[model samples]
Target: MKKIVILFILFYSAVFAQSKFPVDSSYTVKSVYDKVKKAHPYISYVPARNYKTVKEEKEIVYKKIKDRELHLDAYFNQTKKRNPAIVIVHGGGWRSGNKSQMETFAIEMASKEYSCFNIEFRLSLEAPYPAGIFDVKNAIQYIKKNARKFNVDTTKIAVLGCSSGAQMASLIGTTNGKIAFEEPNSDKKFSSKVNAIVNIDGTLAFKHPESIEGTVAGLWLGGSYAEVPQIWEQAAPLNQTDKNTPPILFINSSVPRFHAGRDDMIAILNKYGIYNEVHTIENSPHSFWFLNPWFDETIVYTTQFLDKIFK
Candidate 1:
């Protein structure tokens, strides 16, 4: 009778575990960290600055999809002279995140004489892969088209993003003039090419054999590397490096997962004679951009990079 009771208990436990997070689902289950984050979303981390001269224009519509209106927030000092611009893309593993998450960074950049556009894009939940690429490209084109209105120097623009956003920014910087990635109704007259790229610990390549099967990359790309090899290659910035690729700055954590393919990417860029630099923050978490001290250091590295590239 005890053996039969034990068997019944084991069966019930198995069923409960399967129901909690199904093993055969197309999407991977969210990590414990992701779950905790969803319950308590992170707040913005803006440092104390003496400069209070920044101005902002919030929720400027950039694209319309059916009834959905995508928008960007612009920040700049009200200067007569046009300033160089940076477009900030927030990261949430391609499934979550919004433009406002990067507002503090934008405000800081604005105070430093750089026009900043913090943009919103489709996540993997709404659409996957090329959808994000197209949205970011469209945002850049929009900014370029309306540069005069924003008092931006159209020629001096950079792309900066964290995590998945960083990956997308890298793609924009490397794949300029790649017609296949351009959106259908985008402003073709103005180019989406950026002068520099700042990658904040995003993945650079996705073709390795030991790559995980159902994490954020798998879900965002819509399949495992084995199932969608071409898409994986197409989405990787490492595979898209070329001569025309602009200078890149990498602000990264010491985590191996976040810095995957960093060496390979640098090697490819070096081979093509492209300028790039990597700054790894020791003893910091992957999401250090959202935390203190690290946040300040991030901005310092970022501004230095922009100053050099814009010069």
Candidate 2:
């Protein structure tokens, strides 16, 4: 009797969990847009106002090499044929951030005939440095492995992110086709790579003299410049750029420290004969470009660049 009771309890829990995120066609694009607006209240425009779910796994499960149970949310647009894809990485100083922050962007991309995904990676304090990069690589591989099912053009996929996510995005853009930090092959034979990148106010170098005292470098990298110099070098996206890497779009603000040395990165790309673009906002706060009219301009410029390259 106790065994039967236990089984029934497990069954009910599963059902409850499933019921919480029930899929409903009645959940219109406008409604989803409304939810996004309610949450952000800052984004100025909504592009992908509608999407037909090509694929969705609300609580898709993944077990890391470390045996960590990672939950990922994924959605794909079925409405488009052979669409380009964009994977979004969110930012929270590498210690905190979720996949949800990219939902509106994902939905908008889907609406615009581009398959999109918002990814969640392990956090810094929660996990560590290479873990986040590992998770992102895994996500890219997962998408490529399921490309046909999602109607995503694996060859044309782009990565975009903000803050730490921007660091990851730049990492992908600069390191595509390079296996600098690849894990022991747990799944497939190929490396995960992106064709383009959109990075927003992301830190590129941990070697900055300012990073010596106290800044994100100390917190996320787990030590001061003197303490973990090699770790900083290894974590820097600036260390990863090459010729075969994707074309890049850099979005920076007028804020001090944050936008510093981005031009240096562009210089490195130019030295390597790589294609890149920089769009700097005139006298704005760090990531404040995410607010009101600024967001609209940012999105417009970004999407316009995407359009130019995608075609």
Candidate 3:
């Protein structure tokens, strides 16, 4: 009876979320516009600044299914030295947010001679938890296979994500050798291993005892912990951490609740002698990466971390 109840709840949630997050331009699921609207008085836009962008290639399809396609935008600098790369994921509670949310990061990083790809995956309203996870992992695999074309140094690839996207980044970095999270593609020999992770305000664990993920998370995660225990456990980076997990850099907002399981994961990383850094942007609101001043600080921390690990 309990198993039957769980399946019913999961099925119903998936059906309902699809309706709520229907694919439309107005839904802004794939737009650069901020969705965390007016949650704070300071939650306003800052102009995106970048260096002399000699080249930017947009709408490059990484994954496709019939008419539906997942695209990534790549930013590049003029350099013969195979550039270090980043696969960026944006966050909007896993139900909203588009790839373009991270365009500023890509443009800025590219100017610094790093190749960055901004990606959009299936949101909870479109699919569910692991779907988004596999999309990112597969995107990494795609990047590795197409390294030469993108002028990327596959050995120095990193996954950078913001908000819930950060949670997904942590999970992807930890589960490097695992096949369960893979979404198989034409590149059978390609590996999705990332050398480092840049997690911006994404919690390490969703099934933590104190987790208050709420409905937005549930919409992406499929069901509550009671309904889908395994999915919740599998999605948490803290649970998947092993010696193979890459070094991680966490940039968090001032919110305490968002730092769920961070210290515990750091302990695990330390035990394995895996390098990690934590930078809390003091007095900053959540989604500060999309804002100014704090966003610049984040870049400094991220570049230093990535340089330490990859350079």
Each prediction's TM-score versus the true structure:
0.83, 0.78, 0.86
Root-mean-square deviation (CA) per prediction: 10.0, 7.2, 9.0
Give Cα-based local distance difference scores for all models: 0.81, 0.70, 0.82
**Which parts of model 2 have CA positions greater than 4 angstroms off?**
1-57, 62-67, 209-215
Whole-model lDDT, candidate 3?
0.82
Report the C-alpha lDDT of model 3 over 42-141, residue by residue, as the tens digit: 5556576767753688998989866678888888877777888989988878877788767877888888778899987998777987888888887888
- Summarize candidate 2's per-residue lDDT along 1-311 as a digit string, tens digits: 99999999999998777542222232233443455465456555433344456455555654355445555566677664777888888876676657765676666566666777787777755656777787887887887777787788887888888877888788777776566666556366545778889988887776664233256546667787688888878777777776776788888776546644577778888988877888887755555434555666677767877877786
lDDT of 1 by residue, 1-311 (tens): 99999999999998786542222222121332354355345523445454567878999999988767789999987888889999998887887777877877888889889999999888877787898888888988899898887879988999998987888898888898888888878888989888999999887777644234257788889898778989999988888888888999999987776766778888888988888989998877677777565788998999999998886
Cα lDDT for residue 265, model 1?
A: 80
Tell me, by TM-score, which candidate is best: 3
Clashing pairs counted in every model: 0, 1, 0
TM-score of 1: 0.83
Task: Name the weakest run of 10 consecutive residues (lDDT summed) in model 3.
Answer: 24-33
Of 1 and 2, the candidate ahead on lDDT is 1
Off by over 4 Å in 1: 1-51, 209-213
